[model samples]
Target: MPEHIDKLSISVVVPVYNGGKTIGRAIEHLLRQSLPPAEIIVVDDGSTDQTANILRSFGSRITALSKANGGPASARNEGVRVANGSLIAFTDSDCFPEEDWLKELVKGFHSLEIGGVGGTVRAASGGLIGEYVDLHGWMNPQCARDGSVLYLVTANACFRSDLLFQVNLFDERFRKAGGEDTELSVRLRSFGYEFVFVESAIVRHLHRRTIRDYLKNIANHGEGQFILETLWPQQRWKANRRKEIVRSAAGLGTMLRFYRSYRRQYDRKRAFVFSLLDHCQYMARIWGYLRGKRELSSSSLRNPLTRDPSAVVYPNENLGSSSVLVPKV
Candidate 1:
């Protein structure tokens, strides 16, 4: 620990599933951070590809763990199991970060009230779909005053290890990357945890390029919103009963404004086209939300203990001895 800086040991946890193409790059970036982690832990969620092989080659440089096929939430929980650091920094396998990323993250801990810190998750260059995502600021970690955030995105966020334990980790029920972080954030907010946004601790996120993938992401976000709404009703953020006509009209107005401001980035023609596409995607998201609502209702009826009155499972019932530590060096 330096005299001027507080001693905050950070462990970087990256949960990867079939990210063989990008995991290597993510790890390489972590290794180069100015404020490197005490250990870089990569939790492989039963990837059937060369992801496991790629992790194996890293050897002692990182602690690689493999678990049965679970979503990003469960994999991240496993990473916390073996983490031996005061702070737990999380990022996705597809992110390539700037060198000072961790250094900037650590500065947030100067205030003891700060529970977590988030960096901007910028979109990497892709095709039209990616441009739409970036334009919309989808999945990007947002700006916040030092201590005035609900929670930060897990893709480029760091939390106090004790705070995570107090919250009992993420809900394993989320079988995708979608709603788990938001759910966790809701809990942290209720507990009065202060989340900060570090503009400099940035990572470039790889957005989906293909239309199919982009649409799938939009739908997943909708589904996750449904699950989150049900799980944390106290948040009291209700969905609009009206979707198509009202939302599309509002979207059109927003697009027109967006185009005028960002014409250099996306011309009028392209902006108009993307806005229509965005509306269609939003419509598709409504469908997904409805399906999720139906599924959640049925699941709740079958397992009465599935949901708490507060929505999330507090004290994490599944914090059993089942989690394994696969420190494959």
Candidate 2:
């Protein structure tokens, strides 16, 4: 058995960039954690909004850091730098955790071998895209080979401070949100670190509610995924291509299976409607992924600085000239 939970020290890190509207609420919910953190640190990444003023309202209740607006990964890395606890917990400024979120997640430590933990993320809004994401298991936890979690998103994840460093922190090159967290997860898993999915540790995500916001989110995810593919050719599906002669027939069979599965989960009418929308999202992801691939190749040729022996252009960030990571690879 593991030692008592009180023996552990945890710190919460919230990265804010123009999060004036929700940062206060997030902090409010965080302050209510059953197992309070050693400290709550919020890093303001060059926000042009009233975010700075709002954070000041919290006064000494929190530690606030101001820096040139780097992407979430950079901001998060900065928070981890100033953190003193044994565990570095992360949550976006827009996400609010339940009062018991910390208590529930920390329980996973009883397993002793777990190096990371992820919590369930539920939609706080009922907008179309948000509702679809909720029903589609967007934040559903996956089981790893050792019966732990396969991946953990920073939106509701905590890492053993030492382990986070072992994986080299979040990829700052991912100026966007989607890929950096997964990239870190992939690297950590490669090292055989165990991460658990704590169902009781829950946070409510204010997901994109409109078609435009949803599209942007999916495209970003696609781009990030392509970046992953570029960096890890072994993971690129295109790298392991196979010839499927009967494409149309195979698609039909897959559709049939999906329909059957959906029917079992919901009424036929509802299933059909949402399934169509879901496919739209999936198609968008494919488009983004392909676009990312092409753009990555173009960028690599256009920006030879990426070829520098000292640093790389973050493999596939494709942000053109924005940021780069110092990788030994």
Candidate 3:
């Protein structure tokens, strides 16, 4: 540990929606961290289920907040607003962090230049879809060719609270649970702050079990990709219809390669199924990309002058009235 580590305080923020069944377990795991956080904040993003009741059951163990059905980005922004720690760690309600997760994440912030640190995600359950997701390292931090992290997945990531404030927190325009983290990372990188990846800081995530769920996740990612490209045109490459078609065509070869790789470990039947799902994933992503393009175009037409992709809005600036922290019962 660095000499300055003792001066840092950490807070764990969990943004959840309709996660009544798993939120308790996630909180439990957080509480058992080897390097316990100074505070644990869970933001309930207007869940229609028994999520509120479950949160209440946690009592004073966590600081629970309730708000309208804003996306994960908005919910996370709310959590960051009230966090009392210098380091804010984020994880999903469906994730279970290991005992040393926080310790390892904190260790990565040994210097002032590191704006954030992220860990790897492992699948909690073992099913066909789960295995596929784990095998492909689906939720791991996306890295550059030289091993620099491009973006940290929020499923297991920690960032400096001050840096987050400087970036104006998360972009609420992302009305879903994807791409907002990537955009934040890009903005953070712009400040010349590096991000470290701590392989030992592991979190077990409950992956999408069914094929329908998996395909939906892939499609949502496609939409997020479009949003990122629009928001940071200079940083992200814009894909045209020609590029999209070419990418889709090339996906066939990728699928075959994945199938061969899977066959080496699993049975032929399972490999075939995995390859088929990969094809479906490609189609779903393309559809989502096209849909996102149309939605963005419509949004631009509706508010041509007011729309500013570069602007970062903090939660207190606009969302203070709409979001409220529920007092501990």
Top candidate, metric lDDT: 3
Pairs that collide, model 1: 231-311
Model 3 global lDDT (CA atoms, 0 to 1): 0.82
Q: How big is the RMSD of model 1?
A: 7.2
> What is the per-residue lDDT of model 1 for residues 76-192, given as tens digits with 9 covering 90 to 100?
999997998878999999998899999998887666556688887777665676666666765655545653676578889898776676667887777777877877876666666
- TM-score of candidate 3 versus the correct structure, residues matched by position: 0.87
Q: Model 2, which residues run further than 4 Å from truth?
A: 144-147, 238-273, 297-329
Clashing pairs in 2: 45-69
Question: Cα deviation of 283 in candidate 2 (Å)?
Answer: 2.6
Which one wins by TM-score: 1 or 3? 3
lDDT of each: 0.75, 0.74, 0.82
Off by over 4 Å in 1: 1-5, 142-147, 239-246, 249-265, 297-329
For candidate 1, the per-residue lDDT at 65 reads 97
lDDT of each residue in 148-244, candidate 2, tens digit only: 6777888899877766654567777677777777777776666566788888899998887566677777878888887876665555555223223
Candidate 1 local Cα displacement, residue 317, angstroms: 26
